[model samples]
Target: MISRLITILQESELLLSDQEIESFSEVQPLLNDEDIADALWLASKIGSAYKVSEPAAIKAVSESDDAIAIEVIDDNTVVVAPSPMVSAYMPPAAKSDNGSMETPELGLPIQVQAAPALAHPREISRSLRPLLRKVPSLTRSELDESATVNRIAERGIWLPILKPSPERWFDLELVIEASKFSFIWQETLDEFQQLLEGQGAFRNVRTWTVKEAATGQPQLVAKRQQGTGIEQDQPLRSPKELVDASGRRLVLFLSDCRSRLWQQGQIHDWLTLWSQHGPAAIVQLLPERLWSQSELDVGFAVQVGSLMPGAPNSKLQIRELPARTEIAPADTLTVPLVTLTAEALKQWALVVAAAGRQRSPARLFDLSWVSDPERDQAMAVIQPQSAKERVELFMATASLLAQRLACMMAAVPVELPVVHLIQQELLPEVQSVHIAEVYTSSLLEEVRPNRGRL
Candidate 1:
């Protein structure tokens, strides 16, 4: 019965077939249905160990019988299924208490229903099983259509393009005029070129051209053209075409030319040379002109009467008057004045020294003394009068120096005001004079011959 069951499974392409049963029966003639069932169950168990279904195990065993099936060489020497196990095969069913259906290898009864057989046999292999289980088969046209849809969805969109700009269209020009003349003119083109090359601010200048003008040429003399947009092969105007219209020789200097020249290479050395030798060189080049102008003299006078002590008893007299030398436009002078009482002068020799030190070309004026008749009377009335009856006399002298400053400058006036002299502790007594006002007048005055002079 097991052999017939195997044949049915093998032929039906289901759980067991007739061909597999016949092949197994041929291998062992004495083997009963129980042993055959056991072998089929072992194959199913191997398939189950690999997570394969019963139908897959059955198909695998039938297709590769040498790896999955038990064989018989002769009746007495039957060959059992190769061990350590061959390939994976189907597992057996368990036995149930009622004995209706059971797979002993799985410890449970088989539950799968068998598939119907067709006239033609369907070949089973490991490669054909998975496709047979899910898709059965696929067409090339359908696979291509699916791939095309996937590619279209994965790609991005296209964008618009921009145009490029044209290469050429505009021109520029610089117009220069050469008619203007500079103070320090360069005589020749070579000289001008050398000057431009020297340095400072004029180093990079290459702009202007110079030429001479004919007598009958138009007043508008020279013109300068800029090279900013000109072609490399374009012809330029000759030096003769550019000229200074005025009859005098003309020289042109472009703005910033001199400054640029001063700033170029070796400028520091050039500047040092100029600083050390330039001024003297210029003085030698240009000498000062002589003056033929005449000179004029002016007169100034100061009053001498202010130096007197009291009211005059006689007319005033003019003694020797001081004379001052004429001064240049830029000079300064100082004058000194001195004053003291007769008793103070007799007590202090410093007072006299001070007067002598301050003396100038000026003269000393003497004033009439106030006479004491009583002192003269005492000298007559008593034989050897006491010193107490002697008269006390006070006198003061002042020395003045006239100073002239600068030929164009006039002398500034100074005033003298009367002031008392005071003595500080341990210090010599000194008289102080204050200046009150100043006036202008002649220094010479006429007076009686016998009058006291100050």
Candidate 2:
């Protein structure tokens, strides 16, 4: 009977280990009719839980003569009829002495519910069960290839690649543009401005007050008048008001109301505003306190442009800011920004892919990676230290990297190096854009238990 049951189980697509089969055989003799029923039910449950086909589970049930009935609850669940033990567990009728008063209620047998069927001991063991669910029987060649690739992809470790460098310095500019319109939240701006005035670049700053048309609130606009004898009380609201700034580049702080920086519309707006002022260049400053996170070793953005002139995408550059660079305690701080020429952008992409190979906490690249054949070949040379390490690597790069890159695309496909070839092919047509900017300020506030609230 045990051998027959094993054959049925295998026919039903339930693969059991040798030890499991032996254990099932050992316990087969001890199972009453009820136990057999329960075992069959357990088998059905196992098949369903492991995503085995419903037909396979049904076939297993039909093969078992001991199983009076089988009912499928869903693709993942099954129900079996009550065992003989359950049907036979009625309470014995009470005996009446002399049979003088035979009360129907007292003579009637009381029905007792049967206990739930127990799965095979070996089957119930967590360690052994996982081994059983090793694969599905999908055998199509295309499907098999897809499944294999997906399994590897799901493992989440991006294989890093090393390629020949172009040997030219990435000529990029970090344009820090400031506008008279303050983008900083009023309270945050006030506090930060006070701190700046107390310490670094704004030691001798002149201020002008203007009432906002929308809010009717007084907005204090600050300017660092170090050399030109502009009075501290001069009322300057717009870029046009700065008459003393003749030939030199105008550094103004424009408040970015919208948080997303990659939007083409935002870039267009900046360009339009810059064109009006006629400054040789513009400098934009992001709140340093908000950007600083231990995860990112660097603290600055670079200037990057496309290979094609007038590409629909913005010419914004991104790069790692050195951690040790001195920050002036001013609302406006100056730093060199790099612009990415066509070749430079490609080189940067290669460098980014290479940097991802290192197992270190970094912030330069949004948690995204592009796969290349060369990178995969390079990564194949190194073996993961242990199972734990391999698992960790998968979890870090898996969905995180892919999702971030998707977001960076923002409905427009930019031909970036190091991404998969398929992604490049799909770029022009892939319209979905999901951008997620990592603001470390919020994370820092949450993780620092000992520090006071920012």
Candidate 3:
């Protein structure tokens, strides 16, 4: 029944956060689906009975961009976001014997539980900043002739402190996943989405949700108001449509990876396509401990050779390699699974920023996931390690543009634009020493497909 309810939320386009999902998972058994839905909708909003002790705190938290996703409710308060989208789809509640509407009582009451872990998912979502903000941020500095001449004439200085023309980058696309029938869990989720947009450090954040369609295919959805004056779902976009060929867009998919569509491999195909074209990663909706239970661990976890804000390697080699005797190479795609925690996002920023660059041992997402039921949640294919190790594992798989820049400079067939891309895009590029080492290694192979560029 709980599983069925989860399915409802996913199908209804109500995005719930990890904490909310956990709350529902532990809910006491419901008499039926309608009761669960009514209980959830009314519990957070039952007049004074459901009101918080600190209404000002609620207002302040709602107004605060930083405080949005964190846990603010006490034992007495059941704070759920009211979603017309949820109410529209949920079954109507049954009335009592007297024909008066029966009030639904919540199955989940606040209780003492295990101590909070070091990493809180809600707090992490509110605070995690993207380390790699834009991909290949291109720019050119032009001399400000008027200012420069004036300065030279007035103060006898030659520095232009040039005016830079940066390329208009793509917006950050935040994708979230909900289950089949979990409309009741949308409260904290709306706040979580707002947090990502408000505090995620991206200039523009476009959130698109992934949900299981009635046909059982997972789809990309947008909300639109119809001519009749009611909000309705727009036509679904195929997951492949999310790809940006310029490798500019930074795509973040937030999911617990428990949807049937996820386990069915439909989600995996598009994720591969997204990573290949540009920077993309799953902002894991599950806590770290339960990663093995989901589809996150299907890939072999080899340490990558290199990453960004760091020099690229010449023919990178993965270290401390785990032997995957049974895992086939063709089945793996290097899609990063990242938690919303600070350190994890830091590493993910580096790894994903380097997605889709040419490398020796293939590239990240080279070995895509083949979700196996036997292996599903049985054990994590990619185990938790230090952020450095995570980055190394990712880059060992192959760092993208960073390694490319190193290769270009190493071979000495450097284009001004490519160098500028690194210097401009990667503002704090790697040190001269690293570039010098690439030159010193004598490891780069020069290829001349066309003599003009060479």
Best by TM-score: 3
lDDT for each residue of candidate 1 in 37-67, tens digit (9 for 90 to 100): 9987998988753332343233224536345
lDDT of 2 by residue, 1-454 (tens): 8797667677666757566667988877544799879987997988855443445446535645466667777666777777644454656556667554332332444444322111121222221111121122222222344445665688864444333322211111112222222321222333334432442221132333332333332333444444664425434355333322122122223232122232212333333333233221221122222232211112234333233221111222223446674544221111221111222222323322232221111122211121122422432335356657754543443345334554453343222221222233433322111111211111111222222221
Task: Assess each prediction's global lDDT (C-alpha) against the native.
Answer: 0.24, 0.32, 0.52
lDDT for each residue of candidate 3 in 287-356, tens digit (9 for 90 to 100): 4544545555554444443454222222233443465545454554555556645556655554434544
lDDT, residue 151, candidate 3? 92
Residue 296 lDDT, candidate 3, scale 0-100: 55
Candidate 2, superposed: residue stretches over 4 Å from native: 1-220, 223-236, 243-246, 252-454
Q: After aligning candidate 2 to the native by TM-score, how far in Å is the CA of 317 from where it should be?
A: 16
Cα TM-score of candidate 2: 0.19
Please report the TM-score between candidate 1 and the true structure. Answer: 0.10
Of the candidates numbered 2 and 3, which has the greater lDDT value? 3
TM-score of each: 0.10, 0.19, 0.44
User: Model 3: which ten-residue window has the lowest total lDDT?
Assistant: 358-367
